[model samples]
Target: MARPKVPRLSADRIADAAIELIDSGAPFGVNALARSLGVTPSSLYNHIDGRDGIIELVRGRLGRRYLPELPTGTWDEIVVETMQGMRRLYAEHPAIVPLLVGKTITDDAVIESYDVLATALVDGGFPDDEVLSVVAVLDSFALGFGLDYASPDDIWQPGTPTRSLGRLIATAERGDARSDRVFELGLELVLDALRLRLARLRDD
Candidate 1:
């Protein structure tokens, strides 16, 4: 009788399995991941530090795939590009957002992306005290837009005829196009506000 060929298990394999499990809206855990990988729970510890490790691995995978290396450009350009990329990343893996936010980010690649954003804001005249606040605003804005992007095409379904939003929903475009327009408009508003803040800081 031929022996069974067990699939090789590694950190990357663990990460991939965890992502698929999360993407499927399944409850994720070391046992769940190990089962998905056809391995014993103890076997997983050989490659990861357990739950937190798995989360970081998933984050790294998503980051490498969707996050950008902020390019040489104006601060606004850097921010727009970074935010757009972050939104796409989360939009594609909305399930991972909750997992990621619940932990302190320890992934080097993920940290580097923020480092770039921080450097750009600082170089662009934002004070050290305000750098993280700016980053937080951008982070929250991108995550919100990302969740919005993942939402159903029909954002609103008015059961009965009424004024205001119901009427607007009747004619408004649904899906990606509408979401894209709103996201861009929101970005513009944010950027304009940041510019005003920068000007005020310099004047003060």
Candidate 2:
């Protein structure tokens, strides 16, 4: 028996299509994705559970694509590297960032990434109870930076504003440079604080 010419649907293919639609700022769903693949909405269920499944698929894709190789640097160095990769990956997929921000992530690779963070902190002398706290803080910083990177250049457009506010807006750094400088400084400050805390705890 000859198979049909249409491509067989799968989770990866659906994730790719969804990422494309998201990149183009088009609204996507079961019907839209199926249409893109030349299949009916119900056909989508055969491969993917629904929209949430596809989102997790994409999240996993990013996890694998940008997940850092294990590095031999000190814990802080490794953390900085991982966070940088994480931020850039999300920044690259700005259209999908909003959709993912509030969802509870269940992707294995994503979870593994967090595990890696916890392990690094433990190795760096973070108390077991405090390891996840540092992980949470770094994750928040990187994700927030990702969203900031996706923001429009004109974040403020006051029709009639005060001169100080106007001067501040006029002089603020724009684009990736601004985001990078802030991220670097913020990460460094965090690492420094953690280093100090660990030293104090060790002596106690």
Candidate 3:
């Protein structure tokens, strides 16, 4: 009789398994991930730094997929492109978005993306002291919009006790179209403000 072949476990493999579990709406846990990969929970730690490490690996994987390109062009262009990519990635994996916030990003690939953004902002006239604040705002904006992208189309009810909200909801567009419009408009407004700030700094 032939011996059974065993598959090898690696960081990438672990990340893949985690993604599959999350995509299927299964709660992510060390034991669950190991079981999905046909291994024991202890074995996972050998390839990853336990749960937090695995989550970063998963984040890197998703980033490679949706945000593979290094953005070029003007600072606004770089910021816009990177933010759009983040939004798309988080929108696709809405469950993973919350998981990302708690962990300090250690993955080199993920960090590289941020490094690119930081470099671009400095080149675009933002002071070193303010670069991180700008980055945080961009990140927060993307995360919020991404979650919004995943939310229900009919967020507002038709008949509300408050007449004004009901009236406002009536004119709103439904579905991803609505989300897209809002994301674009919000992004434009942010960029406009940044450009204005840069101009003011130049004047000063």
Candidate 4:
């Protein structure tokens, strides 16, 4: 009798497995993943071209889940909503947050989502050249904030257990109003500055 042939895995299946592993806080490595999937490491090549391909697939999945059609609203409202959405998505997939911060936008879905926001800014009288710069600033701030918020106790190192924000705050001397008040004040200041810049550009 002939030996039975193994089933071939599709790229989507491999990507799905990788995502599940990452979301479960497992270290995403080829050897371990191949073992988990009951295939040789070489089998992954039939699915993903390489590690970068895997990263792109993961990013695509994240973008699909998080980057919905943004609502038609004022620029500030859109920014706030986009930031909130990004924060929620990053929190759910903390393992991939670092990848998001360091990697370039390789996934088409991710790129398109960003383009939608940039187009909105351009339509709102912002210059085309500055739209992407503004978006980069806003996205970097949101990602940094989300990472800090999600991993409050982690001592900025890999393989370390994260600390709770409450514990860290308890060490500080209690005196002034909420720290978040300061954050809100700073946000308002930035918005005001942005508005002034827009006004000056329009006047010119």
Which candidate leads the pack in lDDT? 3
As a whole number from 0 to 100, the lDDT of residue 141 in candidate 1 is 97
Question: TM-score: which is higher, 1 or 4?
Answer: 1
The candidates, ranked best first by TM-score, are 3, 1, 2, 4
Sorting all predicted structures by lDDT, with the top scorer first, yields: 3, 1, 2, 4
Model 3 C-alpha lDDT per residue in residues 36-138, reported as the tens digit of each score: 9888888888888888989999999988887888899999999999999999988888888778988899889989999999999999999999999999999
Worst 10 residues of 2 by lDDT: 64-73
lDDT of 4 by residue, 1-204 (tens): 675586567766776788788888877777766877889989887777677787788887777777666546777767666766775677567788776667677888778777777877788889988988999877876665555444334333334455675565555433223323433565576668778989999999
Question: Which RMSD values do the candidates have, in order?
Answer: 2.9, 3.1, 2.3, 7.3
Q: What is the C-alpha lDDT of each candidate?
A: 0.89, 0.81, 0.90, 0.70
Candidate topping TM-score:
3
- 3 or 4, greater by lDDT: 3
2 versus 3: better TM-score goes to: 3
Clashes of each: 0, 0, 0, 2
TM-score of every candidate: 0.90, 0.83, 0.91, 0.71
For candidate 3, the lDDT comes to: 0.90
Instruction: Pick out the ten consecutive residues of candidate 4 with the lowest summed lDDT.
Output: 173-182
Answer with 1 or 3, whichever has the higher lDDT: 3
